[model samples]
Target: MVKLFNSRSSRPFRIILLVIAAIAAVAACAHADTPPAIVIAPSPFAWSVVVALVVVIIALLGVFLGMVNKSLGKSVQIKATVKKTVEDSYARKIRNEYQAKQALLDKKIEQVRQRFTMVMIKVKNLLDTLDHKELFNAISNLIEVDIGASRYVIFLVDPVKHELYPFRWQGYSDSAVEKFSMSVENAHALTYALKRKQTIYRDAATSDIELRKLLDREPLSNMLVAIPLFGKEKNFGVVHIAAFADGHTEIDESEIRFLSTLPTFIGGALANADIFVQTREELTSAKQVTEHEIAEKRRLQEIFSRYTSAELIESLLRNPEKIDLGGVNKTAAIMFTDIVGFTAFSSRMNPKEVVILMNEYLSRMTEVILDYQGEIDKFIGDAIMARFGVLSDLPYPAKNAVEAACAMMEELELLSSDWANRGLQGFNIRVGIATGEVLAGNIGSSRRQEFTVMGTTVNLASRLETLNKELGTRILVDEATFVQLPRGVKHQKRENVRIRGLDTPVTIYEILEQVKSAKIVSIQPKLDQLASRNNQSTDKDALPDTPPVAGIKRPDN
Candidate 1:
């Protein structure tokens, strides 16, 4: 009972009892019928005790109310804290669910993005190739591996015959591929795709009889996809894919969509290949034409360079019209060279020896003349006639002629020493040069023509060459040639010289040496060595104890 009274439920009853006792006390004090002894005049101490008791009850009630208010506030705080904790836990669960869904969504998006990028890379590779074989191989690998096809064949369209021929194929024998040909008139999948210019998908269980019939001629397959390759201008070809090898009977929507996009790329590749082939053929033809032109130029050069200077041959080749059977009056320097004592030399030898000696002499003289830009006009027996400044204007024709003469003399000296060493007879040569206006061109009939120069200049040059024998000189130039000769040309003036065909005597000069620039310095040591050998041989043969032969003369003598 004490615990009950002290409990919260008993506190309000105690306060109610206290209020009734205070009221009863006050009423008894005011009533007149109450006992006088019991209701004696209330003492101050008694009144004070009653008042203190009331004050104590009021204070206890305030304390109880304060304690009740504090308990209620604590309960509300605990309830609010528990509610907030529950709410936070629920919100965390919801946020975790949202984040997991978002993460899954992000992973799916990333996977799709990667797939798209890979497909784009494959498409780019397909488009970048130009080789037809490589392109077909790439296409086959893509269809078989990436697009999940088991077998495939690429057919090229022949516009002329309106036929489709297997160009590149997989999962088929060479003979089978060779025998595969379909006409556009035929009811086949390739033809159907080509006519429709779209991708056709046919399954074994397809309800459409027409589609089934179109794929009947193809290899035994449960599913067949035919894509027509169309170029910018016309239909190029078609690609047929079969799904029979890997137990795949049907193509999904994504695979079908990917197959649908292959025609554009394949068609573009085919068009580029055609252009490449056509361009290669054109380049080959152009190369052939250029080669023929070069060959003709070389042939002409070989033929013309035999008789004229290389520079003249080049000019004639550049302007082909210049080579005609005609004559032109041009100021030129004419030079003639003849072997000294050739008749006596040949009479002492056989025909073979004579020919060999003449060839050697003439070849040496010809080289020297051409070296100085002089053209070999003709070979008169053991003589050579060359012309300078005939095909083109030369600033120093006289100098060229004199220098050529000097070179020829030097070459002959080397040849003479070489011949002495070889136990062969050697002869001297004479050169004559003259400068004047001459008719230079082709000078024979159409059937047999010769390019030569003719006029007073030619006659004068020949006459001067003949005059060398009498003057005991190697090279003689007429007044016209001497006057034009540059300085540093060593010469001896022979004034007022009479000629066989001239009315009056003409001035001539014997060319002794060439300028330092035109001299052949490299061969000097070789010439000197050969000369020393010849001198030693001669001295050895002329010993004091050896008697001189009566009929035979020394080779040099």
Candidate 2:
């Protein structure tokens, strides 16, 4: 019975017991209520029996109530326990899910970190490699390892050929690789990637028939990934990776993303390498050109020094731009000197002796001309044509010409004395100077060019030089040169004479000598002044009309 009360069926059982107790109490009340034949006054015991019956009923009710309350409490406790168990189960399930997701997230993070590290290392290697071959090798290794590619080929665009040629590759035979070339003009995956400047993912199984046919000869498993290598300005090439025919090797989204990013570094490295190579080649070429120029300058100096003054040669070398092949019209002092009686002198002497004497005479005269900063235009047999203020503008070209002429006369006298001492015939030289405008520049054919002056001034100087023999004078000058002569120079006006190539008579002057005590003014300051003024205008008329020569004072009248 106790077990029955404790069981789930106990509620109905207790209710049946309560209903039976009520019926028994009602029967006892009915009996008591009935008029008993033997009783006049209600017996105390009867009342007490009724009271006891009532008390028993109340006690049973109380016990049943208490049992009901206890059942309710037990039911509440059971519900609480069941709810706690459900909450614990749910928490466990939730914890497991959280842990799973967290683990997966951590794995992804680690993968990203690893990819980053690998990319950094590969980029460093690419940067360190300067040579093209080494750079290609590094790129191949980077792709194969970092991208988890089974086979890969790096193709560089041949801009001229309009094609893509493999620069580096793996998992392909040399012959196959060499034979494999794709025209960028063709419509294909590689070209598409290059044209779009993006990564292209192609599945051989689903790819177009044309693409599949193109890949049939290659050692590709099934999948192809074409990543365009971008440079700073243009596309360098494409990196083609073959993979995924086998189930074990697959390219995930992460690897695809990595591959996409890798081309930037690769392209930059390639561009930098190309620039380095070009710069090196350019520097080498420039060095060769500079060396050649130096050597040519040396050769030119050696040859030119044999004719012109050292100072003139140095100036020309310093400012090579001054020696333009195109002629320029400028006012210059032209001087000509000739050995008197040279034809007769050579006729009497043997060929070797004639050469030796002529060389000695020319050498002495050349020394005097160069001492005055003159350019020996050319040596015509026994005659020398020299110029002052032709290569460079001089403030005192006329004075320099006159001084040079006088110095040559003195030098010839010394040579004559030397030749007399040596038991050789003494020689005489006549000089002529004229100041006027002339065309000065290199003049000749392409094969052989000579720097000389041409114009009326040159003709007049030559004619005056020949006139010296007729006038019985050693040095003769035109009026233009005489007016510019220094005050201390000994000169006299001559009768006007007509010369070859001139329709009018030309006034001449004989330059006897220059004052030995006169001091030579440095030409550097005047050259600087002239240079500054010439910068404003290069026209011939811009020059001073009658600039006096330096190193000597000009005559007042």
Candidate 3:
């Protein structure tokens, strides 16, 4: 049984060896065209012959072994290649799906950019139009259909209060104004974004409680976005937006980074608008001020034109700095005048005729006022306001006034004759003269202006003039003025006369005139008699002592 098994094994090995031999023969035949390395030219070439046959057999055997190894290597390599190909096919499938999803994401991001661009277009249009109502409505209706967002809220700023009150509220109710008030000093997202001057977006609405409540009843319950509108030192306001219901947004941090440029532009636009509004207001105010000043200047020119010569007024106006507010101790002449029986004479004429006669009287008085370098403060009907030796650039206003008054009296005499000849009632005038320091200048508003004189000296001179009718004299002179008069101005002694608002009565003089025209010299003794009567009346009337009102100029006009 052993022998039989040996025989079967031997036959199979022999058959396999024969198959190997056939493959070796084909390999040897393929290599037959190649040459031997060294020539066998030795006497002992027999060894070379033997080595060549052995080499042939070894080569044939090596080819047989190589064929068997190559077949086994081919089977192993086919199995490895099949396994690698299967793995690569599965990997390619996964890669294709991942690339497809990435492409979709990229497309969605592009769509978002397009939507933002559309909204910006609308924003630009609204800015150009500058119509508030239209701008608000357009902003409220601005849609980003591709991105699946509904509307936006646009706020215009008021930088003065350091608060963002919505100058324009889009896509929201009036109550929304109170809802979104935020302080910039805080560390919240909106405040942070404003401080950094950039756009800020919270991807999830629930991340911020206030935002969740703001859109609680709305569709944008997923996410919220807040963008600051600011540039340089100015902030226009904020723009808030949200996603639509059933929509998803890929709001990356990098997305908002580039939007900083847009807010800058918006802020610039708002700044320009503010400048335009303020400029318009400034122009309007300037025009109003100019018109008012012009009107006031015209009124003043007309008023002062009545009081003094145009050349003199122009001099005063052109050199207002030359006017000294402080009084100067210089030689001057002060004069006062009054009408006699003017009240009784006015009663004789009708109201219109009285006015005409008064105008005529004032016209004649204006001539004397100008000739004496005097200024008229105001008119009290038939009374006149003339000042001399006060605020006169001339050094001798008092003397000029005295001479003019003398000439006025002579002219009045001639006027009286003319009135009598024309069946008109004739009137007489009393004049007083005093000299003292007095303050004078342009008074009242710079626009509505007046030129006048003030001080106690002016009051005393006026009081002296009023005393004339009671003294029954044409002219009077205070003690101070009498001392400076020329030797020819005749006067009589008069006692101190009690004047209103005076602590003590003033001694005065009466001028009898030269039977033509004159100035007062002395009436001081008569003035004292009136004062004695006033002192007695003071005890009876329980009032300060004052002279009887036999002659007093009433300020009716």
Leading candidate by TM-score: 2
Runs of candidate 2 exceeding 4 Å displacement: 1-303, 513-557
- Residues 92-161 of candidate 2 have per-residue lDDT tens digits of 9999999998898778768977987888887887787555556666776677666667677777776545
Model 2, residue 175: distance off in Å is: 65
lDDT of 1 by residue, 1-557 (tens): 88987987566568766776776677566554654565356556665566667767777876787679679879999999999999999999999999998898777556545655666677678677644455566767666666666567777775445677776667778877767777877777778788888788775325677776656675323337778988777687787776546777676554555566677876776665542222222322333324444455555555466776545665655555554437787778999888888888889989998888788888878888877888888888888889998775665576578777887777888898998898888988888898878887777876977778899889999999999889898789876676444433566887688999889777678877543425433444543454445543443434232222221122221
Tell me, by lDDT, which candidate is best. Answer: 2
Worst 10 residues of 3 by lDDT: 548-557
Candidate 2 C-alpha error for residue 233, in Å: 55
lDDT of each: 0.69, 0.70, 0.57
Please report, as a residue range, the 10-residue window in candidate 1 with the lowest summed lDDT: 548-557
Q: How accurate is candidate 3 locally (lDDT)?
A: 0.57
- Model 1 spans > 4 angstroms off: 1-303, 321-324, 513-557
CA lDDT, candidate 2, residue 462: 92
Which structure is stronger by TM-score: 1 or 2? 2
